[model samples]
Target: MKQLIKNLCYPLIAVLLFSACGEEDKSISAPEIVGAKLVSFGFYVEDNEGVLDKDYVVDGPIVGSDIEMKIPSKIDKSSLIARFTTSEDNPAVTVKGTVQVSQQTANDFSIPVDFVLTNNSQNNRKYTVRIKRPIEWVKKVRFSEFQLSDAILKVNPVDDVPYVMGITNASNSENRKTVLLKYENETWSMVGDTISNGRPSDIDFTFNSTGTPYVVYTDYTNTIPQTATVQYYDGSSWVVIGRNYNDVRVSYNSICFDAMGKLYVFSMNNAAGGVVGRRLMNISTYNGGSWTTNQTMPGRNYNTYNMRSILKKDILYLGVYDYANDKGTISVYINQNGVWTTLAQGMRMDGATEINYNDLDMDVDNQGNIYIMGLERFDSGYKLVNHKYTASTSSWSIFATPIDLIGNTKYFSIGLNPDGGLSTVYNNLTTNSNSSFVTIDKESQTWTSPFIFPDILNTKADMAFASDGTGYIIYIDASKHLAIWEYIEDNE
Candidate 1:
């Protein structure tokens, strides 16, 4: 850390030397009066046409004439504009004796530069400014004990707190109960009663209009035509939805609430009402009294494996891994109005069956375009790519993916950023010697440096965002304890 000192000149020439430390030099002295003091300073990144790119303003008090600016180390500081304010109003600031204008003068700051602040073209103060990339404002990301033995995590967009739904005590199956926990004040506490007796194959939650949480899951114990159930806590006991909707046995359930607060559960075999075969997929909705079932896309024997969905306004998108034509391929179905259509039968090159497939993840942006992070066989090994579906063109194209993510990583998930940006996220827990959750923001088109988990065990991780842009990442660690990161800022 370098510091600048406020030099009080006693000679006409003001030959004062500033050290890397905060010490002022009395050697080779030649000034007699005090020069203008720089009150504030900032380094900015701008385009060639003077459009502001990024501004690195000094965060703390500027001591004397030493200004220490802190910015992210990843940002390039080679060509940058300097902006500063002087104690004297509208004083001319210069670097290396060339006349400089604040916010207009560009300089190469790969090394420390000297700025001379002149009060009236006569009295000037030489200020040495140094920049540092400080990663200390926020705490270091270290995994701590999270109480949920097994869990699915979510963050409320309104409250910005992490809400988890999973098995409370997995080691003791007799006493284990599916529950929801809210993380607040550095503690995990139960929000509602025990949801179920044991862990289900797929477990997730959604919020109703009144902000009440409603969870949906498949019954893992009943493999003899399993049952899909939805429940919510009503201040006391757990209230089950569609319990009387007849034999609604299904598995791999994912849920969400529409703007009308209607609960829509996407699963196979028409779990909400109709008892179809395991090949048919349906979207069941709860309408106050009874739950109704509607086939999402009819006549297609959709593979129910890894079934997931996302509904925004009128557009509803569903994705599943299809094993048709004796080859596993990624399949997508879309519902715009009342009509459901197939976007792609098999998302392979010309629907070829020679490709081996892994799991798939899909999300919808604000503009209703769908994105799929589908992993398939590419070249000699499996490759995962982000495919974007354009509604206007009715076509799917590959987006820029700088890294081989899904196939190479242990666990990879794609989700929409609910903080109101149309951006999507690519989060993966890498299989490195020391695993890290590498979160790639789609809009940035660059890789985000991940926080390393030194002894991470569980690759399962979930991320949620609050309204204030705070992100909470929760996962079970190698110690079978719930772990979390407040994630105030990007590591780089």
Candidate 2:
């Protein structure tokens, strides 16, 4: 009886062990997604009838596909949809935050999609889907007989035309004449009369909502003090915005249009020993009629120089070089309900001993984020620094610097691209004679590789993007002629 019971126990134990081994083997053979692909993509346009569907062909990579998609230039990147396929059927795919196979908002300013795939056994893998703007080529054009020394190129947001504003050597007088050229029909035409009113020192150009061009320039008319005046192009002639305020000595001026089409002009007042001296910055506004002195910027000191200001929406951003203190400061002021309030002041490079700021430029994107770029000196070396004012957080922080940026560089300019990214043009000081161009990748917040234009001796180069996603760089070429490097989508 004992032997029979022991045999029964042994067989039961063997059967139980075999069942456990079988379960473990089954669990080890879990399913997995091997591959994925973006099969199709497009955008939806809403009309009175209904939503119109437009599809795009996907002929790019399969492994973490990097696709260069072309759409209508005016289309917003936030409104894009993508359809994808996986190696195995029923694997999950998601984009932008949605777990839908047909995903929308996948191409929001080059943002990568997170494609999460899960197999039958609940095993998962994630693939990144990148949609890039089509590769573009830079086209070069030389302007004959036009010297672009100390000039600026402004592009029309509506028509994509470029206007060149510069000073040319005058044959009649000892003074230089201000020239404005409009690019049309593949040629640059003089807009109006050559400005010979005063010695053109500095100038700024902007446009209103109705596509009207306005300019503010500093002029020294054979007098002891310089005056700044604002004017607009009225189809054929240049019309002055207001009576020239001659008492205040204007050193630098900048112009910008607000959301309501109202124009604002910021001028640096250089008068000495008066109430106006205490208020070194002056602001003027034009609301379709007369120009009015809106408000004056406070916190004035004799050490302030290289004052630059920009108006975005209702916020005014100001950057000034403090020569006396060896520092550079940026400030912000906002207009809320017709009342101006200072948001920030005296924000400078922290813990820097010697600060020499130059070529200060500022721009704002559609999201109300402000970017200010310039050169600053540090213990390591002189480097280009960008300070960003985030609208969402209401804070100021350092944006980014080029990875290869070196010391001894000058001529820093920043502009907002049509896709709401930032573009920067500067001279590489290490090379001394070469100019460099770089852009910020909105998705990654990283600077693109520095595009160095070799032997570009000039200290200034301006960059602007058109409405059709075309980039234009205006610089003085080796021949001292005004040249434009036009960048367009390179389909090939």
Candidate 3:
């Protein structure tokens, strides 16, 4: 790409001469130097702020002085360079400087050079140049199985975070392993790993108001019936808070906390095929010490598949599929006298008839309201349903389900903004195209497409949002490099 350099100089006198690139010419008059500095070296991208390599400092390139500087090329621009300098001073002071730009690919990328210059005046003189280049992301996003993938991006208070914690298998080989991730800084890194056979699944993690980090996931290990475990990180390592050996295979697990910092782990489980006669659906709670297990209400059990579980405040909720009737139902349980009491029975939305609803996803807001997003089937076709749970009366309110997400059946993920609004992302396939996006006003009772991300194609990776309400989509690019896309909201 072409580089535009401004020269900010001092006086009206100016001289234009073209010769092989050389050093700043000290003989240039004060006015020439000031005027030249006026339009110092700069770069820009359409509609974006100029991001010059601020690491470099330039007073001016003397008309005849040779100067060297390193500048970063915008990835979107073709490899090219342009140099220009000005000699303009706002306070009628003489200024002179030289500017140069060059292109460098990833292999030959050069370090930015700093031209240290003095104002030469009794007072300090500051010359500035704004640079802009095409916005570029990392070449590839690398993934490894059997490891945790947590990416902590820069925290901007105004953004609604998408997803923070996710479990992904970096590779698709026979030795595929599960990876647990936690985001801390601007990068997503591995934190914990489970055996390949215990393939990590249905993971939920969150940091309480006190900054205590907690996570829950199901591990399908041979030793114990595939079980759910709770882990907490105390600024150092992940420690298992609770472990069960009841021969109950757990699935579709989630973690949440109440206003009192109590931990709750909700998971769907089935008895050992040979031992227990009936499948068991449960919500387990840990009060920083012991674990208490609670089973779901009658009619909440599904003989064939897993159920999605979530907790808001002190109440527990679950969404299960009725394989027999081909319909989906939600149930809630409340704790009374330290025991979980079934508060509601199979509650179905107005038009929810199909029972084959899978990939059920749920989220809870600050006001103790619960929202669930999942795939639904109908005689005519398949559709998506985003429903809410009003805890005040233990009721279910079916919100608008966007039809655009019909194809994004698997890998469905959701989160909430600090204001209790909802956010969601999933993969959609269209013949040869794939796309994903977050829902608008996620917690609203209404459904509309005010904000939708561009369709992302061919991604076999996990996505997450930061806590500040901004959504970040992470995936491995064609070259296997981690690619990050930030969805930011503007302040009115």
The TM-score leader among the candidates is 2
Q: How good is model 3 by TM-score?
A: 0.55
Clashes of each: 9, 1, 105
Q: Report the C-alpha lDDT of model 3 over 1-492, residue by residue, as the tens digit.
A: 122223333122243333223346545555433222323442323222253333243445433333433343333222223333433432222224332332211111132323323333433334332232222222233344334332222222233322245444356433433434534345556554442344556566655665555666666543574677677666566677776633577766656665465666655555555233344456566776877776444444554344544444555454454344445555445543345556444555556565344555566676777776656655555566676768687667666564553443555556565556566666565424454454553224454343333434555334444555455566544544445666544321
Which scores greater on TM-score, model 1 or model 2? Answer: 2
Residue clash pairs of candidate 2: 136-490
The lDDT for every candidate, in the order shown, is 0.61, 0.65, 0.48
Candidate 2: segments with Cα more than 4 A from true spot: 1-129, 170-173, 222-225, 241-244, 257-263, 271-275, 284-295, 299-303, 307-311, 314-324, 401-404
Ranked by lDDT from best down, the candidates are: 2, 1, 3
* Model 3 residue 396 lDDT score: 72
Ranking by TM-score: 2, 1, 3
Lowest lDDT sum, 10 consecutive residues, model 1, at 135-144
Q: How close is each model in CA RMSD to the real structure?
A: 13.4, 9.3, 17.6
Each prediction's TM-score against the native? 0.65, 0.71, 0.55
lDDT of 1 by residue, 224-269 (tens): 3356767888877788775434255675677876555557787766
